[model samples]
Target: MVRKKFSKKEIFTGIACTLFALLILSLYVWHQTESVSLGYDSAELEYRVTQLEKEVEKLETIKSSLLTLDRVENIARDKLKLSEPKEEQIVYEHIEKER
Candidate 1:
């Protein structure tokens, strides 16, 4: 029976190769995890944007209703106690244009 003994250099080389392979595998796993995390972050941001858009639409509707002519007239009449001026209290203005 003949047995071949491994040299110290060969043993060290094999260990280094195994370590390098493990490092590559770990880097791959890390990259995949990072990609998944970014996807979740993007989804969360999209959801937040959708919610903000809805809120903006609601706020715009409220503003539109508040700015209606009838709403403004009612607020002025009820809050300021104002009324239309009579014929004697009304005034007119005239301007002459230069030719």
Candidate 2:
């Protein structure tokens, strides 16, 4: 039967190697966590961008409709009762004094 005892130098080298391995492992885990967090933030920003694009498209459609002659005529006729003047129609204006 034979048994080998480790020398002081060998034990110290083993401890140093173990510590280095632990440090590397901790750094790798931290990097992985940060990567996941960044991915989630990126996805959130993408979703917000998509929502804003949809809103912009809707606003563009509304703007186009508002700029049409037909839409303007409809609003003027319905809201303001505007009409074309006939030859027989007489117009009068009365001015009020501002106090």
Candidate 3:
């Protein structure tokens, strides 16, 4: 069996190469982790947007139903005991628009 002795330069080169490879691998792993985390956040935000849109639609439907003319007329006639104006009590006006 032959014994081989390595020089100081060779040992230092090997250590430096190993450290550089480790640093590159660490950077790659960190980048991949950030990408995955951002993907999850984007999906969560999209789901939140969809939920908000649905809520807005539901609120608009409720507003429309509440503002119906039939309901308002019923409330006005029955609750306020108001009657229609007579022909003598009515007046008409004409207005000109500015250009």
lDDT of 1 by residue, 7-94 (tens): 9999999999999999999999999999999999999999999999999999999999889999888888999988878998865644
Per-residue lDDT of 1-99 in model 3, one digit per residue for the tens?
A: 998899999999999999999999999999999999999999999999999999999999999999999898888899997778999887564432331
Candidate 3 regions exceeding 4 Å error are 1-9, 78-83, 95-99
How many clashes does the backbone of model 2 have? 0
Q: Please, what is the whole-model Cα lDDT of each candidate in the order they appear?
A: 0.92, 0.90, 0.92
On residues 1-99, what C-alpha lDDT tens digit does candidate 2 reach at each position? 898999999999999999999999999999999999999999999999999999999999999988899888888899999987897685444433332
- Model 2 off-target regions past 4 Å? 1-17, 84-99
Query: Candidate 1 or 2, higher TM-score?
Result: 1
Candidate 2, residue 48: Cα displacement in angstroms equals: 2.0
Compute each candidate's TM-score over C-alphas. 0.74, 0.57, 0.70
- Per-residue lDDT for 20 in model 2? 91
- Looking at candidate 2, the ten consecutive residues that score lowest on lDDT are 90-99
Model 1 / residue 82 / CA error / Å: 2.3
Q: List the residue pairs that clash in candidate 1.
A: none
